[model samples]
Target chain A: DAGITQSPRHKVTETGTPVTLRCHQTENHRYMYWYRQDPGHGLRLIHYSYGVKDTDKGEVSDGYSVSRSKTEDFLLTLESATSSQTSVYFCAISESPGTSRYNEQFFGPGTRLTVL
Target chain B: AQTVTQSQPEMSVQEAETVTLSCTYDTSESDYYLFWYKQPPSRQMILVIRQEAYKQQNATENRFSVNFQKAAKSFSLKISDSQLGDAAMYFCDRTGNTPLVFGKGTRLSVIA
Candidate 1:
């Protein structure tokens, strides 16, 4: 198991409020990604970071923002939470293709957020 | 864009029996990767198996094996000696230069 952890394992916020979730990894992997899991959707990428201060949007980047100021930490923020944004958010880390060609991401436990 | 499809929403297998879950993907690129991930009741995502497009032989890990057909763009997972612990939601994913595209998932049940 990769040494990855997500903060605020569970959170609740009212609609129109701001919320943030944090992901930390001890492995010092170069790739970090944020995803969300909903009832009908298995998992959708929200954002990804290849390095500190470098980030890109994903398939479902609406209503979400992410920042990676450090190698070990990636933050996902919801400027104004909406009911549709309530879902289980997961953080993943992966190393670039090197000696081992299989580049699979290691996931954190995940953060369950609810918007009222 | 790549799209992964899991036709079976749910499936069941008796203890000790073997079962196969279906996954099909559409992509224009030949160099890519296919993956199967298991999410048990704990919601932990476990990498069951992965297949590299360049590899002709199917990828196998213990009881988990994948039947990958490049022509048909199909990748199916076969589980042998099914145990209750094997029961979980299975997701099929595909990736190349882009982020992973996942199927909705198939709920697997193992009956004693």
Candidate 2:
């Protein structure tokens, strides 16, 4: 798991509720990413942070917001959860992008969110 | 935008046999990276192999190898001596200046 941990491994929430998932890393990597996995879709990046307070949106960034106040922690917030937002979320960390020799992303176990 | 395509949605192979998973991508960048990641029932993403667009030689790791055709915009993974543990969901992805764009994924089943 590359010293990465995601809180709330499983959560069942109702629609219109607010949900926040936390990702913590001990590796102190410079990059952190939030991705969602669903049927028919392998993994789609929701958001990523290159450095503290430097975050960017991904292809599927709508309805999702991210914050990285610290290097080790990256948080994903669903302002108002919806049924479509129910999926398995994964957190990944990497020392750098493709330029680094250790460019591979290390993923956490994952957090399963179910919205009714 | 970079897009990865995995043509096969599902494939099955007998134990000790060999199987090839096909993946193709559309990228305009000359310098990029391609990767194959595996996710078993545990749901943990594991890196199987990677290929640099600048490298002409294929990348191999033990029984796992890749056939990278930079000009053809194709990268395929070849697994030799398949085992039960090899059964999993495999995703193909490419990265350039932005985050990795992944394929829909292919499910592999290994039968003994």
Q: Who wins the lDDT comparison?
A: 2
Poorly placed runs, candidate 1 (over 4 Å): A97-100
Instruction: List, residue by residue over B1-112, the lDDT tens digit for candidate 1.
Output: 6789999999999999999999999998867888999999898899999899989999999999999999999999999999999999999998778877889999999999
* lDDT tens digits, residue span A1-116, model 2: 48999999999999999999999999999999999999998899999999999999998999999999999999999999999999999999999886556778999999999999
Clashing pairs in 2: none
Using Cα atoms, each model's DockQ against the true complex is 0.51, 0.78
Question: Relative to the unseen true structure, what is the Cα RMSD of model 2?
Answer: 0.8
Q: After superposition, how far is residue A98 of candidate 1 from its true place, in Å?
A: 12
- What ranges in model 2 sit over 4 Å off? none
In model 1, the clashing pairs are none
Tell me the TM-score of model 2: 0.98
Consecutive 10-residue window with the lowest summed lDDT within model 1 chain A? A96-105
In order, the first chain's TM-score in every candidate is 0.95, 0.97
| Predictions in order: lDDT | 0.92, 0.94
